[model samples]
Target: MVILLNCAHHLSQRLQTTFVNYGEATMYSLETCPSPWLRSHSVWGRYTVSFLLIITQLGFCSVYFMFMADNLQQIVEEVHVTSNTCQPRKFLVLTPILDIRIYMLTILPFLIMLVFIRNLKVLSVFSTMANITTLGSMILIFEYIIQDIPDPSNLPLMANWKTFLLFFGTAIFTFEGVGMVLPLKNQMKNPQHFPLVLYVGMSLVIFLYSCLGILGYMKFGSDTQASITLNLPNCWLYQSVKLMYSVGIFFTYALQFHVPAEIIIPFAVSQVSQPSSSPAWTWSSP
Candidate 1:
């Protein structure tokens, strides 16, 4: 995002107006560029990009929801199975059954509350918690992963083209914080340091992700599940890592939810002729 940051900074200085988020930046950039060719369809450019970003962010939130549900469901089921007890089916209203679908239903209320949070400052606390939980889970899993040594020759160096595409897609998905750059920079206390912050944060993420992939593969060879968490030992300690990761993914959902809400809600609010009376835009006088 160094390039994006530099361009945004240049725009901010020249225009003397802060770019709120990607939509606004794209809109303003297209509208005000020197070339008439670029300025021809600024409104369409903004709307098209906004729709694409909305889909992207919402897709991320959907993934997070399923991820948390799947991990939590597995953890719960494992515990119940070890105890030789059936997973109670009637655990609704009071609680949810040990099923991924039910876990999502159970999670929806808290998820709604989390997304309703309008302040980025407050939302950053959840983001920080997510970072902590994710790192903690990774550390815990890595501890288990490094224990079993396997021969390097046991694993294949390359996969078939189809599976290689799967790996490529997953790697790209894992590295998807680029879409948040403009909004995050807008929320920063000092936006000038965003490039440095981006570099450090992304470098750390790449290092951790690479370590997990390489080390986990070296240890497990080809006998891995969709998630590395699933390949962990079926002990209480390892099971707790699943809970930690579910919590991390839950926390991450809010950040992804924020980007789409910023774009869609503003446009929705603007569509109303009398937005002043809308409860979403303001509160009743207290």
Candidate 2:
């Protein structure tokens, strides 16, 4: 991650073309970079990058759906405690829902409406609130876990290769914000400092995630639920954490949807009405 992050920054600096999207960055990095050896398959680079990003962004949105659903459903459903900690379920549930899938269904309409928002001001407001609530939720989660943690001495060193692959994949998804690197750099007044900002910000993110993962594992051991919020106490404060988390992820759905929208929507619109000129994307090249 560190190597690729710096590589992209330097590569962007060498390319004279301004990139507004990941596809543009990919195309230039392949076709027009200063080093000829680094450039190849320029024609297809934009398409490949767009396809991969579409899949990635869609997967992220789907995860957001499931994340909100899982956390909110735990808060809504009636508690059904199991004696087996290994199969722990239901900490604090308020209402009854037959299936977890139903919780995702309830979130669908709002998510659909969320992506249609083109106004920058509204998105800023929503993102700010989401950031605030997300921070609060993480604080609450940390507080909840630190109360009476168990011994980690008995914990296994590592899981099998399969679970390790799952960990690797999840970590990759966590860092998928790298897709916005070129656009972020492009918007900078002093783009040279952008790399510094990226490095510092991502370093902090890595540190925080490391702390959270270690603490969560130490706190729950083998019985950890899919979400740490679900393991929280069945109280008003903890329940609020669940709601805040859902709201945060809920608003985040729009940001994730934005990337694919820019790539796909224009082409779809162009197909509806034929213009003499080519579609707006323009091969993501200069």
Candidate 3:
């Protein structure tokens, strides 16, 4: 756990330094242009960042989708099958499709629509709500962890080499916000304070990730799910936690999508026709 925490901290600081150096070099372009530093880069640099952003955000979306689907499925199974025997065997309209698939299909349109909303002001409410939900979920998770502390004797100090890749991948996925650091710094009212903001924000994030990862592993041992939320007990409170965190993840998708969208959409538009006087052209003009 200590090693993981240290790794997270160092990785975050390294990302911050990279972003700061990049931003310092391209501050003027980032402030004036829609695509920011990406547009100013060589073809290879632009494509590399674009590919990483697209892949990372897509991975994040998949994680969120699975997180929502798995928890909701568990909650439904608990309520309908184990507790409320009187309820219908299946609650979904698409009986042929799996419940998780049904949920994903149902929510996908709204997520797609959200991607088109370019205005950050319009997304601020959802972002605020997401922050709240995330906080609530963390509190509930900590409560559960403390309530049932596990014996340390049985737990491994380090996972075997076979599982090391899983640990490494999970850590990378958790800290993949590096792609957004430049964009976020560009948006700040006082850009000079971005270092402080990054430091404080990432410190909190590292602390939370460490606590949840360690406590969750301690409690569940080897039986943990891909998401700690899915391992939560089948109760109303924890069910609410799942749903709330899902909402947070749902809202967060748009913000993550924004980075890649800005990078790719401009290039796509440039290929269609000569840049026009329209807002879309102006926003994404090469």
How much lDDT does each candidate structure score? 0.75, 0.71, 0.66
lDDT of 3 by residue, 1-286 (tens): 2232233334446557423322233332333457655555544444554676677877876787777666666666566434322221232332333557887787878889988887665666778889999899889878887665778688988877998888888878876566566666545567557667767888999888888888888887887767776666655677778788888888887877777777678678777776467555644311
Instruction: Give candidate 3's whole-model lDDT.
Output: 0.66
Clashes of each: 0, 3, 0
- Among these predictions, the greatest lDDT belongs to 1
lDDT of 1 by residue, 1-286 (tens): 5765776777787778766556656777888889798798787877888898888778778878888877767766656434333221222232335556788898899999888877777778998999899889888888877775678786898766778877876876774566778878877779888888888988888888888888888887777666887777666676778899899888877777877887777677667677566665642101
User: For candidate 3, which ten residues in a row score worst on lDDT?
Assistant: 84-93
- Would you give me the overall lDDT of model 2? 0.71
Candidate 2 per-residue lDDT, tens place, 1-286, comes to: 4455455666655765444455665666677667666576674777888999889888887888888888767666634542323332344435555588888788889889998885444665787889899999999888777767888999987866778877887877886665556555655667668768887988888887888888988988877765676676666666788889889888867777777776788778666755659555332211
Residue pairs in collision within model 1? none
Which regions of candidate 2 deviate over 4 angstroms? 1-17, 32-40, 79-96, 119-122, 274-286
TM-score of 3: 0.75
TM-score of each: 0.87, 0.79, 0.75
State the local distance difference test value for candidate 1: 0.75
Question: Alpha-carbon error at 111 in model 3, in Å?
Answer: 0.3
TM-score of 2: 0.79
